[model samples]
Target chain A: MELLLTNLAHGFGVALSLQNISFALLGALIGTAIGVLPGIGPVATISLLLPITFGLPATTAIIMLAGIFYGAQYGGSTTAILLNLPGEVSSVVTTLEGYKMARNGRAGAALATAAIGSFFAGSVATVLVAASGPLLTQVALSFGPADYFSLMLLGLIIASVLAQGSVIKAIGMVVFGVALGLVGTDVQTGQQRFTFGIPELSDGIGFVPVAMGMFGIAEIILNLERPEARSVLTTKVGSLFLTREEFKRATPAVLRGTLVGSFLGILPGGGASLAAFGSYMMERKISKGRHLFGTGAIEGVAGPEAANNAAAQTSFIPLLTLGIPSNAVMALMVGALIIQGIQPGPRMVEAQPDLFWGLIASMWVGNLMLLVINLPLIGMWVALLKVPYKYLYPSILVFCSIGVYSLNNNVFDVYMTVLFAVFGYMCSKLKLEAAPLLIGFVLGPMMEEHLRRAMLLSRGDWGVFIQRPISATLLGIGAVALLAMALPNLRKGKEKAMAE
Target chain B: MRINHRDVVAGLFLVLLATIGLFLNMDHNLGTARRMGPGYMPWMVFLLQAGLGALVIFVSFGKRGERVEVVKPEGIDIVRIVSVLMFATAAGTLYLTQYGGVRADKVVTFTIMAGAIAAGAIALWIRSPETDGTMAAWTQGEFVAFVAAMVAGVLAWYFIRGAGGYFSQGYNAVGIGMLVGFLVLAIPPGWRYLGLICACMCIFGLFLEKLGFYLALIGTILLACLAERDHIRKPLGVLGLTAFLLVLCWFVFIRELDIRVNLWPT
Candidate 1:
């Protein structure tokens, strides 16, 4: 405990540095701006900014990226309250009570509750991370190659099942992403697998192009296909501070949300949206004002907002400690770390204590910065909504083109981006989700490496995975998850067959 | 017969890709599964993709499957697609001839291939009758004539450069041809501005290093501004906004950060 406290203090020393603070503030500002905009999310925003962070120190870069994430979470609720439009998926629940509160002339109160609840959750989750990150690392350090392989398999399966689509299609996309990840020169044999004679293909498709193309460019295309819808804001934004009674009602809800969020956030495939939904359900079940659940209830606004923020922070635990990303945003972070020449895993804590701890400490600072930045800036954010998307889209396109070009100063990457943009559009049209593909792509190579290493160690004995207790348990969990995903589909298939 | 068209198309595309990948992997050594080679994983992936494709196709044949209606493009869409393709080909040719160190003969070969493909595409477009009422016969005739002239000019430039031993000068001829082509092609009413903006972006990328940042950006903004339906009426406003954005980009990306890019053509 003393060592942990010492490390955290040292982290604060690094995070509070002028340079780190500036990056954090910048991230928060950018994150809030994007979060306020409908259809733009943190995943795309982080991927877009990934190239820019290549020059910064890893610790500063991650601190800023993390800031952007949680800052966007806070910003998402603002839009939810003001526009009745959820900017990010996690804020969908907030829209229920938040928009109602805004309609009831309690926009300021709702915004304040969201901001305060997020700050509280962010602070508590940061502590949870600091406490559990080291412990998780210790457990992860004991895992062998087979254990890692099984764990990754489990993560991928869980991600596929939890994705918002047909389980079969999601699994297919994951496999497809894994294939895409296998494009470069094979590490073991030094023979290119699918380069098709392009020299760039020998190095594999870049993460930035694929990500920017799919999430950024494709989203722009999708948005442009339809005419813009005017956003309606409530006329009166009364009283930024909550009433004494409202505060009393919100405090317990926020605490419950933070606990629920922190716990769920550590589980694989459990992201901000799930946390927000879970907390809302829990809040509704226990709240004395359950009858007013959907109608301007402070508990509804506080719980989900706190839960999502806490989940957003604690989701970092898996990525930081085990090097296994639980969701797409964390997967992007893993990409950022790899670009910085730091392989994220158990050794990260012991090898780069400063980065690990500094990032955590920066989260608390960033949350504080959000509270300071968002409340006064609420008017400015609302004003920004008045800017027509037509004018904004061209600028976004130019930025994306420039950002992608700056990666390697090669036009081939730009062409690849165009290809992926088309592919991304096709995915959307076909109702396929991109998140599972992204996580699969990130984990594919690592999974292959571990699988190969385990095979070598066990002399190609397939039974080796079952012989090890931890590996066996992980594989068993994966099997159960696979069965769970398959059972419902199988039942549906049988029902259809019988009907026919 | 009543299968979901979207799933069928997607499945076929995946199957084709996997088959090609499988064929490509056949030449590489496939070591045992324990000690895998370069081809091992790709082979497995191709097989998996093929299986998934088959499964998707199978599911599409189910009774409750949703059939997708593929919307056919109108005359303006064809024009936009062809013009964009032309711009990309010319730009790619110029970049390769100038910086990629391609031989003059290879440039000529590529230009011929691109011209042939464009000709085929134009033929296909002509075969497809216009569905929109706005596409008058005269307009179609004018569009076809403009496209043919543009293609001829580009091909003539390639021949002149190839035969006249002035490979570098071919770029100027093609650029002129494209500019004239764009000016001559009367845009149909109610066309989406995104198409024109996309074309402008292609041109901007092509000329980014050659025309310099300021000139390329100014030209792109000018062309992109024309994409708006009201650009003719509100010319000055669009111009001013373009100038402002140019300066902003210059200050942020170049001046403040000192990015190592050429501000002016060398």
Candidate 2:
């Protein structure tokens, strides 16, 4: 505990630097702005901004990116409350009671509760991350190649299982992404696999283009296909303070949500959306006013909002300690870390303590900054929604094109982006989830490397995976997950949960 | 005879891609599973994809599955979309060859010209009054107009081939072909607007180095604005917004960040 506190104190020293603080503030502002814009989530925004962060120090870059993430979580609830639009999937539950609260003229109270709950969750989760990061790192250090392979396999399977579509289709997307990842020159044999004689692809497909194409440009085309109505409540926002009764009702819910979120966020493939949804379900079951869940209950907003923010903060635990990305957003963060020449893994804690702990400390600062920024800036964000999407979409397109082009300064990347955009559009049309594809793409090469190493180390014994206890257990879990997905009743339960 | 299932079509596409990938890597050594060669993983992946594709197809045939409703477009709409795609492809090919160090020769130019003519012919055929059940006389007039537009496109291509260092002959031919075809066929206003915007984006990518940042951005934004329904009614406002955005981009990307992009053509 003393050591952890000392580490956190050192981290606060790094995070409180003027430059780091500025980066955090910038990330929070940008995150909030993008979060307020319906359909443009933090994943796309982070990918869009990834190229710009290439020049910053790794610690500062990650601090900014992390800020954007949780800041967007906070900003997402604003739209949910005011416009009944969940800007991010994690905020979808917020709309259930948040929009109702708005209708009942408790919009200010709902917003405040979310902000305070998120702040509380963020602080607690930051401490949890700091305290548990080293423990997880130590656990990760004991893992072998076979164990790592099985764990990644389990993560990929869980990701596909949790995808919002047919499990089979999601699996196919994952396989397709893995195939795409195998494009460049083979590492061991110096031979190009699928370059098709294109020298540009010898380095493999650029992640920026693929990500921006799938999430950014494809979203534009999808949005264009459906005309959206922006129906925002224009009434005066009431007091930002919650009533004493409301505060009393919300505090316990927030604490419960933080616990639920913190626990789930550490598990592979459990992220903000799952945590938020799970917290809401838990709240509905436990709250005395459960009947008022869908009828302007402040606890409804408080629980999910806190859970999502906490989960968003704690989701970094796996990525930071194990080098395993639990979700698509973490997958992108891994990409960012790789670009900074920092190989994220168990060694990350000891090798780069400042980067790891500084990022953790910045989350608290970012949450505090969000609370300070969002309350006063709420009206500004609402006015931003009034901007016509017609104007917004074109600029977004131009920026995306520019951003992709600027990566490697090659127009071929831009063309690749267009191709992915078309493919992404087709996937959306088919109701295929793109998230698993991204996770697969990011983890595929690493998984292959680990698997090959394990095979080589075991002298080509296929039983090596089963012989190891951890690997065996992880594979067993993966097998059960696949079996559950194949079973219709469990699949229905999953879909029901997803729908909620 | 009638294959209406979208899943089946998607599966078939995936199956075809896997087959092609497998066929292309047939010669590569697939070493033992222990010491996998370059092709081993790809072969495994392709086979898995093919199996998944088969499963997708099988599921599509299930009794209680959701059927995807495919919206078939009108012939004219198909013609317009195909023409745009063809033009974009031609431009992309030319850009790839010229800038990306691909071999650009007579065959490449010929292929581009052939593609342009095919796109133009499709546009003319789809726009023919006979296809729409109009009078035969009008159909004849449309055919004449199509021929005249083709001739004009060819003449423009011939005249502009040696005019400037900025424009390639292949790009000139494709551009003239697309413009003439669009004018002769008189594409629906909405589609035309979208086509122009897409074309501008392509142009921006193709000429960002040659045309520079400000000019390309202004032109792209201007064309993008045209896609809006109210752009025709508020042209000045759109133009003003374009100017304002160009300035903002210049200050942010160029001046503030020193992004290394030239403001004007070198």
Candidate 3:
């Protein structure tokens, strides 16, 4: 314990240095600015800024990148709350309740809850990282291909079953989303599946166009179609403060979210992506304010916000301990580290204690900086909603188009966005939820990869899913959920699914 | 007879999509369960899709068509096409091996090719006299905007023909661009607001490299702003917002981020 404290103190010393703090602050500022754009998410900002980090010292570079990652994520949730635009998968859950809160004039409360929840989760996750990095790495490395496949399968099932409509239609949407995701070059075979001979689609459809189209552009069309809905985004701004009751409700959810996120985030592949969705499902099931879920519940925002934040912090575990990049952002960190002549792994702790512990401490520092930066900025973000819809939509369209076009500098993506927007608008009229489709889209490709690899490993044994302990447990839970969903009389589980 | 219009339409749409999926997917190998090929998962998913869609249609039969659009009796031909296509393709994809003297992949491919052509012929012969208003969904202003978008896209395509990627596909991107414009007619609210923004994006995409960021921004913003009637009420606010947005974007995206875009026309 004393050694842990000493290491953490040394980390804080490195992170708090004058040079490091400025860079960290610069990263946060840039991340927030870009991330607040309609379609620019953290990954895009990080990749764009990655070249700039080449010149910095190894530890300082990692610190700034971490700062940018957190800042961009916070900015993402801000727009997801205020503008109903989720730039990525993690923030999609935030939109379900956060946008509703904004609609209910509680945008302030939702923003505060997210900022505070994220901070709390970050702090706890930082401590957890410092204390048991190696131990958790062992648990994470235990997961095999089957385990990952089963985990993602359970994720898709829960995402669809917990969606806010008929389970059948949601399943159809999920299935279709998977099909859309398959519309690129096959990773294993190098043969294209559904690209229809378009070379621009070899990398698959960019997620930004699909997400922004389905959420932001479609939203503008919907709001305009309603004659009385003009300027609905400019509803009365409520107090930025969470009420005592709200705080009391959010506290437990935050704690639970931190725990959920920390554990899930340690796993590789798409584990961190599941953090917010898992927490959202849990909140929908048993949070004290579960009844208020569809009406902008504070618990919904608090839990998922905390969970994703915690996941973001703990995802560094694989990179720091196992020399594995958990996601694209961490892979970039690995690249930065490789460029700096410092190899990441078990040796990293002993050989480069400054880099390891410093990165850990800076996660907490970055969270603190995000709170300081964003709390003052929430009022301004909500102020954006005050602009009349007529002027605002046009500006948003420009930013969104620019962001989408910038992905590959191809206009084909702009066309994809237009197509999805029309489809999304149709979905709204048809009573089909877009969330499950999105979840399926994000997870489908990963699940296919893992499932194929797992099948190859087990030589086509259908029993392999239940044969492994981890996958067995995951599939067990999924089976129970599916069975409950299937039995109409089972109001016990539908109590929450029906509420959504 | 009254029918549950929403469920029936949604169900038919899903089945149509699955049939298309099966056709496109049949060209790939469907290896056994243990050693799956690229087509295996898609074939299974498309089958599940057809089944789910059929279930939705079957379930809708239990409900009174409450305030729903009644299906014209003559349009039963379209329904027949949907159901037969669904069953035939799903069965062909699954039981491809049972067909003698053909490889599994070839069997599935031949079945889909044969089935799609047959279905097309049937649909043409049994032309349902329903609304058929997908083309009529376009208004004059929207049509003008779409044509302008197409002009911009085609001009850009011709000028940039030396480039690779979608250009190598011979105006496939332009066709894709037009597809989105037409898709506005496929859905609800009749393409007024959605089509305008979509057309604005198309124009922006076509001109951003050549005309530069500022001009494209102004052009697209102007097109999008026309979606609102009240924007003409306060043209100055619109103008000021456009000007302010240009400066803000220049500072934010260009100067601060060093995004690779020319601010002025080259």
Show how many residue pairs clash in every candidate, following the order shown.
0, 0, 0
Model number with the top lDDT: 2
User: For every candidate, what is the interface RMSD in angstroms?
Assistant: 4.0, 3.8, 4.0
- Choose 2 or 3, whichever is better by TM-score: 2
For residue B161, model 1's alpha carbon misses the true position, in angstroms, by 12
For candidate 1, write residues A1-500 as lDDT tens digits. Answer: 99889989999999999999999999899888877776677887787767667668899989988888876777778878888878767888898899899888999999999999999998999999999999999999999999999888888888876776456667778877788888888888788766755688898888888888888877776666545443656456778998899999999999999999999898887789878988988988998667898779999999999999999999999999999999999999998898888999999998998899999899899999999999888888877655666566666666676667667776566656755875676576556678888998888888888988998889888898999999999889878877875575664653342222
Q: Order of all candidates by DockQ, from best down to worst?
A: 3, 2, 1
Residue A39 C-alpha lDDT in model 3: 57
**CA lDDT scores, all candidates in order:** 0.75, 0.76, 0.72
Question: Could you give candidate 2's per-residue lDDT for residues A18-100 as a string of tens digits?
Answer: 99999999999988887787667878878777776777899999999888887677778888888888877888899999989
List the RMSD of every prediction in angstroms: 6.8, 6.6, 8.8
When summed lDDT is taken over every stretch of 10 residues in candidate 3 chain A, the lowest stretch is A491-500
Which portions of model 1 miss their true places by more than 4 Å? A228-235, A489-500, B1-5, B63-200, B220-233
- lDDT tens digits by residue: candidate 1, B1-266: 56564565456555655665676667678788678777777788779878877777677777643333322433446655666476547645664665456444443345444544443344333323333343222255554554554555455455555453332442434443443333443243322332354445455555665667777677767776665555668888777778787887888677754556667875
